[model samples]
Target: MATVTYAFLCSGVGLALCERLLSQDTERLRLCLACRNMHRAQAARSALLAAHPTAQVDLLQMDTSSIFSVIRAAQEVRLRYDRLDYLYLNAGIMPNPQFDMKAFFKGLFSSNVITMFATAEGILTQRDGVTPDGLGEIFATNLFGHFLLVRELEPMLCHAGRTSQLIWTSSSNAQRSAFSLEDIQHQTGTQPYSSSKYASDLLSLALNTHYNPQGLYSSVICPGFVMTNLTYSILPSFPAFLWTLLMPLFWLIRMFTNTFTLTPFNGAEALFWLFKQKPESLDPYAKYHSLTSGLGNNYTQPRKMDIDLGTSESLYEKLLQLESEVRRKVEEKKKEAQHAHRHLAGSVSS
Candidate 1:
């Protein structure tokens, strides 16, 4: 039997998925945690190995926000693996999130309270900025970095006889209105997190349209309202005790809507479900959601996303053009650094 390889782009629920995968098929599967933090990655590897002694879990240092880091990580993967069975594009950020407490309080009395709580739709916004690459940090980390990684690993993912899966950790908050075709980076938006996720939804459809023939399949999933580090960052001003106090309220809200998949394990249900499925069996137009009942039972459901083929194709083309421009800039920076190094060396020798 051929060994299956899985690469996850973040920790949190990605680590949970790793545990699920290894518990069932430790001997036959190789798991790689591609994370920006080597320390956390090493610790996660240790914990997984401690639980499943013989499982193969490797670590790749990758900062998805940095173009050079993503490129280097992809190169490393190419050298280490001949085939990749699954790639979880789960790394994301909602830096400096601003929660509208007034809106939150007002929404509690409204008919759409369930929707507001489940998706944080009207009550959440974020402060976003640019990366060193001049790409919006949220856009770079959440979507384009994963896109570039897929492009770099096309050899393994698009192997002729075999198939590969790309599972994106999208969200219930990914509103169609948040994203703009002209400003793909969400430069002027307060909801960069939502915009980035919406972009991922569009990109997944485009990937299916473009690479399904090449044996590469892409699907997007929402982890519901998971209480990971990202969620904690939403209210940085709040004390730890305040969140603890709000847990009961959250539980009550979960009664009405199953989108409050609060734990990483629960959030990973949809992702883990997809692992058992044949990529060809999935609905490319549907966004699979990980849901949990008030009683805490977990399940997966698919909802059709508000997207169009025309828009998806247009985004794909724009990404291709941006990729070309980014590569040129990276090459020019490399050459300039080399030239400066050579000049310094010559002067020192003289």
Candidate 2:
């Protein structure tokens, strides 16, 4: 029997994974639902317990946008649990998403939206927002925060197996082209969400290089474009609702086409598919699993690009530097906190 923890970001997706894992066997998997919101985390916990009354479910606040939040969450987990098997970096956001109208309509006719998003992908976000950390929200949630979380929780994650796996919930929408080397946050007129996702893809690949030998295995998952709540942000709310009504048909088209995977269950195809294997055996070619029409319903298709070992390595090094700097900040704050506590205690005694 194997003990596993499904560490995920999104409450909905995390719950979905928990439901599937729990349905199998109660004693096999331990679930820790880490979300940005505590109220939502409590609600998710209640729902999970309602279904599986005896499930080992715990809730912790893991806001990836802030390094402090990540460090705090890691500390909380250390206080409670011992070893962690799976670290699913499944929390990401396309904040203030805006569809490229020109590309959408054009892609609809050419049926290229599938390949376009998969291979030479491009993202259009004509909107603006900022995170509490002051970095671009999309970048912070999608890449940087996860980066910090991985750094903070390295000790637990490395305890999974002789070869512990770091699973990154990446996407086919990740574009090597849209991502700029200089501006990772997409400060200029670029799609920051896509850039950040691309950065993560590169970062994941990079992690495998440096960490795989250290008994840590890293793999990135392309959860083909599932009709997640995250995607609804791009369109007018009503229109998006109408569009979802036709989503099944679009999925049907993808059944035969190898380029697609439909539904959250299906979108999770790659994540589930990869779970059956050892991390050391992962395809360096970046094994992509998809569903095709002639295939009935299977996740065994491959597209080009999204596997740059070099870029991945570069991103990994960059994150290491960021982690060092962030940890220093945490230690300084801890020292200040201790100083304040000492002063307060002295005043109390006086």
Candidate 3:
């Protein structure tokens, strides 16, 4: 049997998926946890090894918000593995979240109450910043960095005969209104998180169109309302006890909509389900959702996304152009650093 290698860019749901995969079969499976924090990654690896002592779990230090970090990590992956079966783009951020209490209260009495609770659609917005790469922090961390990583790992992913999968952990909050083609990086938006996620949805479709022929398949999944690090940040002021107190209300809300897959394990349902499926057999146009019923049953469901081929293609071209520009900038910066180092060395010698 061939060894299947899985690389994950998330911690919570990704770890849940890792546990599921190991539980299913530890033999001939290589799992790599690519994370920004080495300490946390090491802890996750230790925990996984504790559960399944014989499992192959490796860690790669990667900050998806940084361009050079992603490139270097991709290079390391190429050095370590000849074949990568799955790449999970699950790292994301929602910085400085500002909850609209008025809207939340109004929605409670309105017909959109379920939608508000299910998606957090009109109730939340975020303040975004720029990364050192001159890209929006949320955009870089959530979408572009993953895009660059995939581009770098194209050789391993698009290999002949065998098929590989690109599974993106998108969101139900990914609104079509939030994303703007003109401002792809979402520079002028308070909802950068939504825009970034929406971009991922579009990019997945575009990737499918381009890479499917090369035995590479791409799909998007919504891990609806999972209480991960990202969710915790939304209401940073709320204590853990307060959140615990709201459990009953949350459960009551879940009775109305199955989108409240609150736990990380439950949220990973769709991602884990996709793993057992044949890449070619999946629908490229649909966004798979992780759903948990009121009776606590977890299942995967596919929902048609509000996306068009023309827009997806356009986004693809824009990303290609942006990638080229970013690459050129990186090269120029490298040369400048080299010149600075040489100048300092000459001064010391003199």
- Would you list the rank order by TM-score, best first? 3, 1, 2
Question: After superposition on all CA atoms, how large is the RMSD of candidate 1?
Answer: 1.1
Mark the 10 consecutive residues where model 3 has the least summed lDDT: 225-234
- Residue-level lDDT for 123 in candidate 3: 91
Instruction: Give lDDT tens digits, candidate 2, residues 1-350.
Output: 65666676754445666676777777877888898888988898888789999898888887888777887898888777777777888788776666666876677578566665444344356454676656777777889888887777778767433766777876666767768766677778557776777787778777777677667777777766556676555565547558768676566667546655545666666666666678787764574554545354646453445557666666677667766776787788889999999999999999
Residues 133-175 of candidate 1: C-alpha lDDT, one tens digit per residue: 9999999999999999999999999978878999999988899
Per-residue lDDT tens digits for candidate 3, residues 1-350, read 87789999857999999999999999988999999999999999998999999999999999999999999999999999989999999998889899998998999899998898878888999888989888999999999999999999999999888899999999999999999999999898788998999999999999999999999999999988888887888889989999899788889989989999999999999999999999999988899999999999999999999898888999999999999999999999999999999999999999
Q: How accurate is candidate 3 locally (lDDT)?
A: 0.93
Cα-based lDDT at residue 3, candidate 2: 68
Predicted model with the maximum lDDT:
3
Q: Local distance difference test, per candidate?
A: 0.92, 0.70, 0.93
Cα TM-score per model: 0.98, 0.86, 0.98
| Model 3 TM-score, 2 decimals | 0.98
User: In model 2, which runs have C-alpha deviations exceeding 4 angstroms?
Assistant: 1-3, 111-113, 116-123, 126-128, 159-161, 290-296, 300-305, 331-350
Q: Model 3, stretches more than 4 Å misplaced?
A: none
